[model samples]
Target chain A: MQEKNANQVRSRNEIFAERTSTKIYLEQASDDNPYIASAAVCHGYGVNEVMAKKSFADVFYLLFRGELPTPDEVQILQQLMIALINPGPRHPATRAAMNAGIGKTDPAHILPIGAALLGGEHQGGGIVDEAMRFLRKQQTTDAATSAAAHLESSTPIPGFGAYYGGIDILANKHAAQLAQLPGAGKALQWGMQMSRALEAQGVGWLMPGVAAAVLSDLGFQPRAGVCLYQLMGAPGVVAHGLEVANKPITAMPFVADEQYFIER
Target chain B: MPEKTFSDQQIIDSLNARRGKIISKTGGWFPGKGVFSHGYSMMDDLVGKKSYFQIVILNATGKMASAEFAHWVEVGYSCLSWPDPRIWCNQIGALAGGVRTSAIAATAMGVLATDSRTYGVYPLKEGVQFIQAALVNHQQGLSAEQIVASVPSRGGKPLIVGYIRPIAKGDERIRAMASIAEGYGFPMGPHLALAMAIERVLQEKYDEGMNVNGYVSAVMADHGFSPDEVYQIFTTLVASGVTACYLDTYHQPLDSFLPLRCDDIEYQGTAKRAVPTAE
Candidate 1:
């Protein structure tokens, strides 16, 4: 019987870490109490010193990359951050936030609810890692050749693909602009060429693709790229959510009964 | 160049069809009238008339499950509802409770965490897919040993999702669940038979046995559930366990769930240095 085998349910005896580890941030314990932190350091930079001397973009880049960005790097990062600040009112993530707010859900849940939906694969942060990996693997090759190879394939070229069956004009412009930056590297330039190659088929720069190109160039890991994509678009989702929060439930369309067709 | 348009008329038409309308095959509420779910009136036909699990399966799969099957599913849920916080999803709940977030938020987050590649609902789908595919392979004149060999291996062990348990060897839940299945008078169907044969091969060759996931997947497949339907039905499989974890920590002192000291974290990155001026 399987139940007899249950007696063999001994531990695998795997050795886990004695404590969690990180190099990102460190909170120095106070002299008085071991539990209390007296000082905080991010990548060896004193928090107070960073706050006084550095811009938010510089600190933000340092948080992930372990070093402060140069002027060109900071500029591109800041611009990309702004460009992706809001996924827009029509986006599903923003709409999720709006739905939560309009339904009078707890204000704290607004961000989480929207952010969770924003984690989807379609036009969301879910595909950012894949996009970043695609850009990294294909950046050294001919962009046009790589793009042509995927033209007939059913799967998208990851970061480089159509948005809503057409080119995302804003994303294309953002990629073009970022590529010209001094800090811009192979990923962004290759992506622009890939976008041009795909333009004939009405497929080009998606927002995630644009963010992936810049982030890959900036040396952010693919997984970090996913969270960063979500984080960058969060402000817009929260804003749209809060905008409709105080309004009545009627603020958003509920789809009339006649329009609510249940096929089954 | 002029703005490019979607050349696929089908996509445009599909979008246009639902532009201003909410077309649903599932049920919705009608104010002052009735709420419908899969052709049954929610209040009249479901409430107080059917078991909660039956309705849950109906809502998930668009097909009403038998009362016995629903009870079997409910028992399956019990097998998985371990209150141990060491499990990943439950740990999320514990962390949320430690931080004093609302219970709903903790449960929601934990449920979301279960949509993972590791030991959760997603893996359950993979388990079902594996067993169902293995059954097909068996019928096509493949022996159990051959079926086991077909699986991709990592580190010289088969990477079959349902067969091997993590953090333990044999599954105790399989015994408990099997007893319940017997009590419910479920026969050994083809899928379960194939699963057992494959388990024998694994036990003899690899010293690994089937986990509860394998048992449940085979039984569910035998009962005519598609992998996707089983996945949809078990969407909140870990919710109860997550809630239990939340309640355990919620009643405790703030930030007390697994408090770490400053030195507890091993910092392996850059050595301490002065912040450079902005470049």
Candidate 2:
């Protein structure tokens, strides 16, 4: 057994006076039958100690949200996960993962690099997260006015265009699929309203906007929505990273005449 | 019974023994020992039931945190996590993408690259502390210049003076974050006011503006987050951005980014002839 501290109690002020290295505080659970912290709580029982059975997705939700989600919530989580999981090599994070693998770096680093990139404010899940935030703030305003306002401010609209002025087919496809889910009714309707409002200006709803609206309707905050996006996107990133780990980067083809150098 | 002798180990252990809890007691209703998160009422009976945000506050500041303030932290995180890849640290990821570095290596490289005048958590944290300290000085009767100058120099430079990628006018991110802070019911403290004053003072005196770095300092100070705590908590907020840069340019051949041929190297020093014929 580890040695107990001198006194088990102290005033908060006193504790502040002598801040020590971070101590892992395990309350009430003594050395014998020690326990680790978990985020799953269901049916008034500890998931680990009490054997509360749940689906993998439900368990994941519990870990982040601190309670088992309803079946509908589970369905939304699944829908979002399947939709946002992988964008393949063209996406920055996936490409990062592939880049790592091509250089024959360790398998451990691939997904991490990809995931990290995807989480940035502009790229990764961050852009969508920002877009969702923009949408929420504009809840009082109509989509057209809001879109115009965003354009005026020079702030990038979250779910508008994938290319310079183009919509992503896959993203629209996912939105269409999600529109049919149990709780996605009103949210999808609102999303389409925004999409139609923007479409005249050659703008369309991308996955993030649809995701943000749908998740928001499902009661997830924008931050939580981004976390979910990140979670769903990681496996695809890792897969890309793993696939190219054995290959050397130099073996990849190069475009002709792309190698111009100034010799002066 | 064997004769008992005082052992040195026992003596040292007893001498080093503490009389009070080194860490504070939180009656926890949250996750512990991987048993899943317990609700507010549980037989687990740790000490206190706290939200994850509450625990974060406890860990950072040995104080209880209100739900609103904790949410402010979430809002703040959303703000800082969006520096695009073109910025300094994220560029490492871009370079990695261009160079075909390992994903982890690129991320690791980018994470490490955060240590600069531009990126890294410490600058913002330290900048906030500087403002706090400066306000104390200003209140105690010191000129703004004197207060700014009073901040110690590492290699003769004030650590938290100005922004990197120096914004010509001012950083809008500050206003964005400030608006968010105001929405959270956070009032501008003396430190924030002092930072603004100092920015103007410096700008008048040295033509500097209070950019995102100064604004971040103000926000952290407003939240009552000690400079040390800010760094400890949000170290990896934008690590994903770094990884994204690596992925952003993956379509190109290895080292295809800014591809330089043999002649691309401008050999200015000790040009030409190397081999000695006599040898």
Candidate 3:
């Protein structure tokens, strides 16, 4: 059993290593592009289109429960959402922001400002908007079916692909996963149709970037998306952080200005 | 009939040889970084002069093999420190040993200290302020029990666990992880099967039955999970399942409906009942 466990761990480690290697290579290959830094910020934060669609529900599950949910678990989530819907603003930070501003302000800006103050630099409005959009879209049509149809019809889908790049395997996988959930048959059906549509149109390959652009146009500010992505990407960040939590960062020696003066 | 060469206690003692240097280095939880460590130091500076307490630093740095892994451990440790008070020192090379050894030392010292204020510090390089607050509370000898008593149940922050499935489709490592997850009673495959099954049922229910929420609850309840775990389990299970099969629409017809099963329920069930059941 120990040996088997060890092997399993080893295999996981290898997969992670391979994933990291590919990412690093991509980073290195794209280092010369000025947009890479900005793109990196988005990618690092997990704000791209793919993550926007699926990770929220996944994250919600992990946060509330210790492990992943089953299909039944997904239903309970829907119920919980229903229960919590219209509970009114409960966040203290938002309340504090609202209270701090004594002067009467426009409700539109005031609400967003209050939300922004409460959310701070880490919250991404774009990610939230995208998530809401995907949720709303899925609510009306089968998510997979719609997604597939969107892909096929060459119609812009919100959260099915990556932003600023090619198709995101992660998002695709996540969407596919979501499609499999109880009642996601329609979504799956749509996704299939979309995929076929995209292939026929020869634009399936470019859908992610287009989807991202559409999301951007739909009021998902890139910076807000980035912040939301960071929050969503917390797990990966934590994983990386734990690796060196105990070890001392090798301090780089600093040379005094006087030394340079003396040499001169 | 073998000669009694050694007593059972003696044999046990021999096997339990004294392990070397238990507390090797301070972890982020105790003193390395964040507001907890900062607050701890501030409080220590303020009260250590007058308070009767021993500030021992519990370190878990030596056990960390990589820079990234160390950072993650530090972050987790920092996050866990919020509910307790312990002074976390931020000095490097102050303590030593593996995670287990350091944890044992901290527990021992924590239990033995006379003053409730006795604390430990574990710092990280880039600790967040929220984490620091937790560490400060820990150093001040605050316990989860005390925090719970003082704060409302719903007011406390929820604990967060982050994970990533970075493996590509068709990777042997992915397959291996799946297999291992299954072996470890993870229910990755079963969960996917169940989700697919539930989705079909939900679709049918929507056509012939109640509201979305009702159908969802019924489906989830059938699988023995409270509604809360459904979304998360579905997310992971579906991701893993799709990735495992590499079922790109191009490769397969993608038209067939997959059946789900109850056996794939791999998750922590609701808290166990308080009473014992008859055999």
Provide i-RMS per model in Å: 2.6, 41.2, 33.7
Candidates 2 and 3, the one with greater TM-score: 2
Q: What overall lDDT goes with each candidate model? A: 0.87, 0.60, 0.30
Model 2, range A1-264, lDDT digits (tens) per residue?
001221122222322322222111112233443342223223333445323356677666655654557778788778878777786777877878788788876776776677777776544566666766666666766766766776678766776653333455566667766777775745565666666555544456666666776667666667777766677788998987887777777765432222322121
Q: State which candidate, 1 or 3, has the greater DockQ.
A: 1
Query: Across residues A162-215, which tens digit of lDDT does each residue of candidate 1 receive?
Result: 666677788888888788889898899888888888788888888898899899
Whole-structure CA lDDT of model 3 = 0.30
lDDT of 2 by residue, B99-149 (tens): 687777777777766655555665766676677777778899997778767
**Pairs of colliding residues, candidate 1:** none
Assess the local accuracy of residue B174 in candidate 3 as a C-alpha lDDT between 0 and 100.
Answer: 28
For each of the candidates, the C-alpha root-mean-square deviation to the true structure, in angstroms, is 2.1, 30.0, 30.5
Top TM-score prediction, candidate number: 1
Against the true structure, whose lDDT is highest?
1
Error of 2 at B28 (Å): 56
**Candidate 2 residue runs with Cα over 4 Å from true position:** A1-45, A48-52, A148-155, A162-164, A185-188, A248-251, A254-264, B1-279
Per-residue lDDT of candidate 3, residues B21-51 (tens digit) = 1221221222343212222443444234422
| Residue B200, candidate 2: alpha-carbon lDDT | 58
Per-residue lDDT for A181-246 in model 3, tens only? 453443234544454443322222122222222223223344444343333333332333333334
Docking class of 1: medium
Of candidate 2 chain A, the 10-residue stretch with the lowest lDDT total is A1-10
Worst 10 residues of 1 chain B by lDDT: B1-10
